[model samples]
Target: MSNDAVTPGETRFYQGEGQTQPLFRIEPGINCQFAREQASELMGYAQDLVLDGLLERKHNMIWAAHYLNALAKALLDDAELGLAKAKAL
Candidate 1:
């Protein structure tokens, strides 16, 4: 029930030259299996957000939905790249 071993010191992805934007943190491992599990979980959550926004017509939800969708895409891309790297090794 601990991830201290796999975890690293810095987890967040920082943007900008000044490091102003702290977008998100990476999942625990660089392995494909971990990537797939994390991606599937994120996709499910993002899809739910989008669906909830569409059904209820909440303006805030819509905004969140967009960001979540983009995050999911980024996560999937990372997962695919991780899978490729893992296969090559």
Candidate 2:
């Protein structure tokens, strides 16, 4: 990992050993760090399922990812509101 944090508008590309194409796009946001972490974890889980050859269980993974995304969004919303509260205090 690089020491520099990813700024908004910048995209990070991943290249796997056997991948001829880009593996994924990573966009970092300072304000939504927690949300980004959660989303990444959820995506990792989904990828594991696919790699394990459990294609039939893909729907479950999708649902899990959806819920995790919602949770992350909620967390980001709270963090944004918390900043206001902190400033007021």
Candidate 3:
């Protein structure tokens, strides 16, 4: 399946002259309920990176939102699958 409809556009937080830092594209390829757990792991990595000075604060927050969104989508997909199974029965 194509990720087009599901993929969210990349974004950057904070602006102006000093905000030119590159942002990371952390789009999750989530399709199953189990895969939804990735958000927590990604958040952990983001926190570590920020603490170690590898990532910016604003950038971390942006990616954090992306991870959470992915988790939500996983839940929605799971619910849809359940509905389909129920219809079959």
Candidate 4:
């Protein structure tokens, strides 16, 4: 339930009660172009996997479909924000 955004190039290490230690690192940059490309790639991969029988066409399809949809939505959102920023600039 933490609403804090992770800064680029920052590393976060977590240790908690009854849990093993884990570390996470955030990448640098807000490269929207790369994000869009990645989102496209992920969507294609999900589609291929589903068609190739690697992914189930049932409940698992729903999960993969959700991720693909989410990625596309995120890419669109980022593009809109980038456009807005460019206009402001």
* Candidate 3 wrong stretches, greater than 4 Å: 1-57
Which consecutive 10 residues in model 4 have the weakest lDDT in total? 1-10
Candidate 2 structure quality by residue, lDDT tens digits, 14-68: 3446776643333434444454566567666655655554566556766655544
Query: How does candidate 2 fare on TM-score?
Result: 0.39
Better of 3 and 4 by TM-score: 4
Question: Highest lDDT among the candidates is held by which one?
Answer: 1
Residues 24-87, model 4: lDDT tens digits: 3224344556655676887787677566554444667756665565555555455445545545
Tens-digit per-residue lDDT, 1-89, candidate 1: 12112322134555457887778865645554554566677777777877888899877877776666665555556656555544555
TM-score of each: 0.57, 0.39, 0.37, 0.49
Model 1 alpha-carbon drift over 4 Å, by segment: 1-28
RMSD to truth, every model? 6.0, 10.9, 9.9, 9.3
Off by over 4 Å in 2: 1-57
Candidate 3, residues 1-89: lDDT per residue as tens digits? 22222322232233235776733332433333333345445556655655555455466666555555554444445434443444555
Cα miss at 86, model 4 (Å)?
A: 1.5
**Candidate 3, after superposition: displacement of residue 42 in Å?**
15
